[model samples]
Target: MTRETPAGDLTLANLTKTFGRRTAVDDLSLTIPQSSFFALLGASGCGKTTTLRMIAGLETPTSGQVLLGDRDIARLRPYRRPVNTVFQSYALFPHLDVFENVAFGLRRRGIRSVGGQVRQMLSLVQLDGYERRRPAQLSGGEQQRVALARALINHPQVLLLDEPLGALDLTLRRQMQVELKRLQAEVGITFVHVTHDQEEAMTMADTVAVMNAGRIEQLGAPADIYEFPATAFVARFLGQSNLIAGDVTGGSGDDLLVTAQGARFSVPAGRSRTDRGPVFLGVRPEKLHLATAALRVPAGHQHLDGTITDASYLGVSTQYLLRTAGGVELSVFVANSGDQQRFAIGERAVAYWNPRHAFLLGRRAETPDPTAPVAGEPVGVSA
Candidate 1:
């Protein structure tokens, strides 16, 4: 697991992949930094896996450069590239014991006396006691750990994971997510993980690239992309959002005025690209404030009138569906702690939120709060 060159950054320049008449990936370019955790996230058939395979040299790019630092590895064979992949199936040999599976790479490289290395890898993945057992004797999580040990033992410059957690149950998946993040921090190798789970990407990755229709729809830190989405699809796909159609008007200070169907809403001017134009203002469900009466709207906040169309109490929180006077439906989340007042389904209410929480298309983040997903929600983008 040593190299003449240091673990180098991975870069894909104008990469493209095609199958017959289908274009799987098109003119994609990305620079995955060294010793970082990066994620390619999208829905099924969004080409995230295809992009990962190209990086691993399993699928040759129709065009582009796959640079391992300054050297191009796109034309090299999978075995020749300084990259390793962990697939969802574990892909461990059924007849091989844990020790043998973990030692397979060293043995293939003509290296003898691999027992110590195998044991160390087993300990790294917390499977030291199960070395003698075969893959069939272990649970799904254990088998996956063994697979990880096998791939990590090679110590490639970059490790590619293709839906490695897709097969696990909810509890095991949650546990492994913590394990994976811990291991990545320990090794400090660049990991490019591909998954359709937004929660997974936000939870583990230092940076997330949201792919769509063979192109990157958005790329940034998890919170940056989530809080200030670049498009309507990113807003709805990552999590539930209330997108109000409006037009940008003049501004005062950092706030801009927006008029939506005769109702005026304020938005942060610094996060918007245009001073006056048609724009779709987006806010998360939890950001909106709901009140039974017309309370004084705070400074830099706008108020809208709505009626509770639906309300569901979920113990810790209450979810309400509110319809504004202009017939625009919006979702509001109210905390159930303290002396929380409950609103009936037919109760008229007003929703107020700070203008700074609003984000516009093709703009920076509106607030310091990272646009990250909720604590426990699946993330994927689709129409």
Candidate 2:
């Protein structure tokens, strides 16, 4: 049995939440399209969860409106609003079996016959045969599905998931990521997920809003956000990057030449954050390639000479830490193969990459943290 929900767009206008003097969510505004999987992603206490709670009417906003389609639902109580939330805890009634647990909402709404619907939802979450099992009898993932089915059975206009997979183990969590995406597509309703996991957001959400300090730092498709980060936070949070500081001194056709430590680097004109000022030129670790010191230079590629300060040979790839003679440090990742050139610590090498893959951002005024490794120091980061 298919449940067709007439989903409507959800909008938050100037929404803010405060706990006394501490503001959890600042003046935030975003419109989530109907039938889209949208994610509010950020680190813990960054206010992603606070934003989701406001939308679901679980947390009262200090100001502003929550709109469902054209109606203002900000003042509406949680049960009065057409929204459902699934939290990290399954929150299933311990004594109730799966069928009754999923049917609880339907019965509350005065629907007498929930047999067919429960059966369909059970199959939807792949627990058809375990319909009579209590929450204690099911695995963590199964309990998660029961919680999902219960909230989704009501066919809410919008569904809010707050770190729903946090308790599951890594293997199960990854599996649930795919399952959740599939369920969202089949149900065809707005799914607003709040998570701190960058990979999870990129994998599941059609659009990801990276929140920071009670505000959205960047919002876009996963690839767009990863490829072209709008802020320094976005660049470092989305993935590992090698950023070089430079100033836009001049230009060529559709490109600007930046001078860093007497090294002229070409950046596409569109990627230039400013017409003529300081900017951070960046590339992802995986985008950079390494060659032997004596190798011939490739045409139309940015090249730099550096000493391999460190190298890690993981099964699938080799990540290298390099420091240039000018004291700039970088990370480069290369696929591991039998014929690939290997590097030793302190060996001289060259890092070359296409200029088109470069990313640039406006410079920030803050100085580097005093506790972190100083210039030309190598640091190990997990994959």
Candidate 3:
């Protein structure tokens, strides 16, 4: 939905929310570019919904500021703000038909000739002929469309969606994913969608903000966020990973030696702050390859000898549990091409990966403060 405002950007400066002494949202700040499909992704209690409510003027922040373009909207009433929300439940009026639901907002604004606007909105959501159908007569998907039409009819500047598709079945969920993407392209309005589903965020968002403990752990394009996760939490949360804990032994420009399980492996350098301390090496299962006798190890490939402790064959790919000689357990995935190479359990194999595939994380050691008390001494140290 579009609104006329001199302020053209959405900004949250030092935003926070608290209930009693429990801080629901910390000092979080973010800027949503105009017309961007931004997603706020996090688990429950991570302050995602609370943040959205603050932006919608449904919840007031304990501290910080909410700016829409140049206007401060933190204190504005929900109706006064140029935004609308599509709740997960659709929240359609059971008694009203699709046309009436869509026209509800327009009617509130004292617009009497709502027939044309209602028709156009319904058509935009692909619900052209269902205007006469009541909510009880429509399917789940149809009801969702009516809710969307209702929100969009108002022409809001920013549309907030809170798990709008959470009620649909798996197949319908996927279908709606495609439909929602297409609709976003057609409307070209700024969408701030909130969901705990990582796949949904990856599929729909132009940019994703990963939130944890009331703070944004990472924010970037979907591909970039998936490929180059900034923290250990992100690496583990975003996807399945084999995290090999180790210490840095040697290094030379963009490459480093990591000693783990009594073996020194050459891993990419300058990727982590823990160049000398204990570090966690992360590798996605798909990145690991099962080295065969006929298969040649590519240049810069980091090879590790392991035994296939377990194996499972899915239609698309084969999963292998490789237990390395150094006692490091790795999950490897091999694509099931036309001719799948089946590796029997307990078979010896070499699991290899490119140096660039590994993600080095965490510091090796904590730098002690000189002014701090010694292990067996009091805080007020006496010479």
* Collision pairs in model 2: none
Candidate 1 lDDT tens digits, 1-383:
23324557888899999999899998999889988899999999888999999888889899999998899999999999878999999899998999999999999999999998888888999997998999999999999899999999988879899999999998899899999999888877888999998889999999999999899989999999888887777887777677767777778777777777588777777666567767777878889888876567677677778788888776788888777777777778899887878899888898888777877653333532123334564221123
Off-target runs (Cα >4 Å) in candidate 3 are 1-7, 270-274, 292-296, 363-383
Candidate 2 structure quality by residue, lDDT tens digits, 48-163? 99888888878899999999889999989999988999999979999899999999999998999999989888888888888889999989999999999998888788889999
Q: Which candidate is the best by lDDT?
A: 2
- TM-score (C-alpha) between model 3 and the true structure: 0.89
RMSD (Cα, Å) of model 3: 8.0
Total clashes for model 2: 0
Q: Write the per-residue lDDT of candidate 3 for residues 75-97, one digit (tens) a residue.
A: 99999998899999999998888
lDDT of each: 0.83, 0.86, 0.82
Worst lDDT run of 10 residues, candidate 2, spans 365-374
Error of 1 at 225 (Å): 1.2
Sequence-dependent TM-score of model 1: 0.90
